[model samples]
Target: MRLALLSPLPPDPSRLAHHAAQFRRALNLGGIDVLTPLVGQRPLESLEAARAWVAERDWRGVDVVHAELAPGQRTVYWVLQALARLPHGPALTATVHAPPGLLGQPLHAPFAGVYHARWLPRLTRQASAWLAAPFTRHIDRRLARRLAGVLCTSDASATRLARRLGLPRERITVLPQGLPELACPPLPSGPLKLLCLSGPGQALRPLQDLVAALGQLVAQGGDDLPPWQLTLAGATAASCFEPPRHDPLTRLQADPRLKALGDRIAWQLDPDPQDLPALMAAHHLLVLPERPQPWGLGEAEPGPTAPQGACDLALAVGRPLLVAQQSGQAEQVTSGNGATYTVGDHATLLAVLQDLLTDPDRLSDWATQARRQATSRQWTQMSARYVGFFQQAVARSTRAATK
Candidate 1:
């Protein structure tokens, strides 16, 4: 099969891009072509730029065009719709990497026509957001229906996307993200190190409660549990400590209780994507404090529907996960591999941490289980599954055209 993947390539630093490159390599039997929009040396910054770039491409004789659609990539949605409408277009499909619900953000921005537009007035954006709030889901549903088929990384995401998109669950295929073959490092001696990774643009407000719980743990001292250290690191060279006092890094840096932990709680405010493997290896556990109401949003707000790159990387590196309940990442944490805590309950989290840290044997077993699980999710296997999905998409599209 000749497959055209609409996603950025590696060296781009997007987890989606890195995965795409992996998938392409693993699908060696299939002629897979990667297409991306770049502005001179760097990635395109706007939806308009992407659309213009795509318009100039000659997608002739491709068997299928599969795009990776994330929260803000409305351009991909537009492309999917455009290609599907063509008289002799390739089969249209997309890997919806986020909850379709979050894709509505573009419609609420001040300059709604462009993705990541920064020059708009603050008041204008706020007003637009307020006005656009009610119909965001409706827009999201329409955007989702544009594709012939959808792919998701987990069953949790598939279920959520099916509901939000008003499509039958059968229409969505669940394929876990591929894991890189990473060699497990020897478990570090002394203090059990924990790592929390934040995306380049992710704010620290969502982690404030987690920070508070860690502060309480620090204040209690390590009398019952083994010594532990946390390194809150960012995915790229951008500060995650912005927008609120509810920020974890800000509280850690400012509060005396948290500061008492000193270097025990470190912050890697700027780290490149290439640094992730070393960070994962150095830490005993990977922490994901995603809540039901993520980013401090209200209960009615739409949260993420899939685990980020950190979760996959941790599993690949054979590190146990400590994720909160109801998060997509939590789905990866089986009792054999890791543990989960109630979403907003800090006390439960504290207890889970103490239990894990107190028993080194259990942590070791969990790490081993994690590595075993990751081995089964390698891209070489995942690529075969993707090929099946792509063929199915083409067959379905062909049937629809006949009708």
Candidate 2:
């Protein structure tokens, strides 16, 4: 099949870009065209730019036109608009990385101005976001229905997106992130190394809760508790505008903790992608903090769901996971693979950590289970599923057009 994928490609430094690149490589179909949203170094900041880019492409002979989408992304919006305007074009489908809504950070290239500003401009951009937020969701939902299929990373995400888009659940496909090809190295011994992945403009509350839990562990240090360290790792996209004060790690360090645990936490912000496998293998457990509510000033206001990259990474490296109750990662924790704690309940997080650390045998067994699970979700397996899904989408689009 002739497939055309529109997404931010590698050297873009975003998780979305990485995933898209991996998927493209794994699919490895003949005659596949990889179109990027970036001009020079960053994503196209305006709808006009995205439209012109789409118009320049000769989409004819493409059996499928798939896009990788996220909130506040104007490129996806304009590309979908162009596709809808096609009287009879390639089957339109998209992998919606996040649900339809605004996020704590200006996820769109144009919204960066709001996040980088300290005062009036920030407020004005924020107000503009508030006004445009609903319309964004409206467009997302509308375009979603026009496509042959929608893809999500998790079942919870699929359910949420289905409801938000007012589309039937059957129309959406839950395709978990594929695991990278890597052997499960022996679990590292020494201070218990824990890893958590965060994104730019991520909510602060989850990290704060984790720090509070770690502080408690430090204050109540005893022979029963294991020596441990937590590493927070994330990549910032080129399109994201981050000032020193707005950086997640900087803000996290500034927050006052109950106990001053020096050197117990490490920051791995924007590590090279090639170094990720080694980094993951060096850690004993992966932690995914919970953000029950989406990122926004108003807790009541809904926002896009978080990505499931950490969970996928944990499986890729065969590390056991410890996630909060509300985390989407929790769904991946089954039987002996991992454990979960109540959302925002740092005490429970601490207790779970202590339980897992004290029992080395259980942790090892969980690591084995994680690797076992990863084997089943490897790209070799997922790529076949993706091909089947695309074929079905094309067939469905054909049937609909005939009607």
Candidate 3:
């Protein structure tokens, strides 16, 4: 079948773009005729072009128009709606990558929230007011009714969308994000080096906690402990670091414990994607300490759902990971493969690190288990599942239209 896969395409690092690329490849492999818009140099320009491009395509040959929608993009939503309303239009299916409910949940802790809160009030107020407003709500209702199917990223997300949109659970499907294939290398001998990969202005507080834990461990006469190092990549922007101008590498640079082991601990400002997997494979443990944010107002309580990309990647590499207990993806981690600790629990983190460093046999066991788990969760397999969901939606939409 000819499928016009409507999405913002790559070399953009946005998650949607990545997913679209993956989807395109999978559809082609499945022998589906796909038409993707040419994404230009700038995003807005490319989106406009894409809309116009899709409008001109022959709908008769297109069995379906699969659009991936991100929340809060009113223009794109309107464009897609217009396309779906076209006379003799193809079937419409939307994959909602980030919905209002998912977006409302804070992905990171204090510092990230502090930055978000600066601009979030106006945005949230506008969005909430718009949803409540009669005309806007009416329009949204019409759009929801017209949509053939909606796809959510997680079961939790699907449930949230069903309640918020008042749509039946049957109308929504859950499709989780997948990781790229990575080879699991044998565990390196000697010190168990730890690595952390994060984007600009992402969570750095967790790294600070790790540094503090390392210092505390050394102070407690754990100097004889096997060497451990941390390599940080992907925080170039100044806003990335928290105040005090002291990063983990900088703080421990001159210290005897880290200095004596020179080059053991290092930070790369930025690394290319191709090099990342190999870099990740070289490490013994991947550490991601994502702190959860409090939800709602007036005696707000900590809500679940911490970021999970790091943990996911670590698992994909088949490496033992140390993630914060509060992270959204912590459920995927297990003692058989890796372990989780409470946020800022330096004592626990230190003990875990020490144990891995001191006990070589246990470290080997963890590494093996981690690799086994990672193999089961490859992106290719995940993509095939997504394709299955898409096929089901297409069939359902066609049946509904015929009736």
TM-score of each: 0.77, 0.76, 0.70
Residue pairs in candidate 3 whose N, alpha carbon or C atoms collide under 3 angstroms: 306-328
The Cα RMSD in angstroms, rounded to one decimal, for candidate 1 relative to the true structure is: 5.4
Q: How accurate locally, in lDDT, is each candidate? A: 0.67, 0.70, 0.62
- Model 2: per-residue Cα lDDT over 101-141, one tens digit each: 31223434454555445565546766756655666567666
Q: Could you tell me how far off, in angstroms, the CA of residue 288 lies in candidate 3 after the best superposition?
A: 0.8
How far in Å is the alpha carbon of 336 misplaced in model 3?
Answer: 4.9
The TM-score of candidate 2 is 0.76
| Decreasing TM-score order of the candidates | 1, 2, 3
lDDT of 1 by residue, 204-264 (tens): 5546667778877766755665778898776332243323223344444576655666777
Better of 2 and 3 by lDDT: 2
> Cα lDDT for residue 390, model 2?
87
Descending-lDDT candidate ranking: 2, 1, 3
RMSD of 2: 5.7
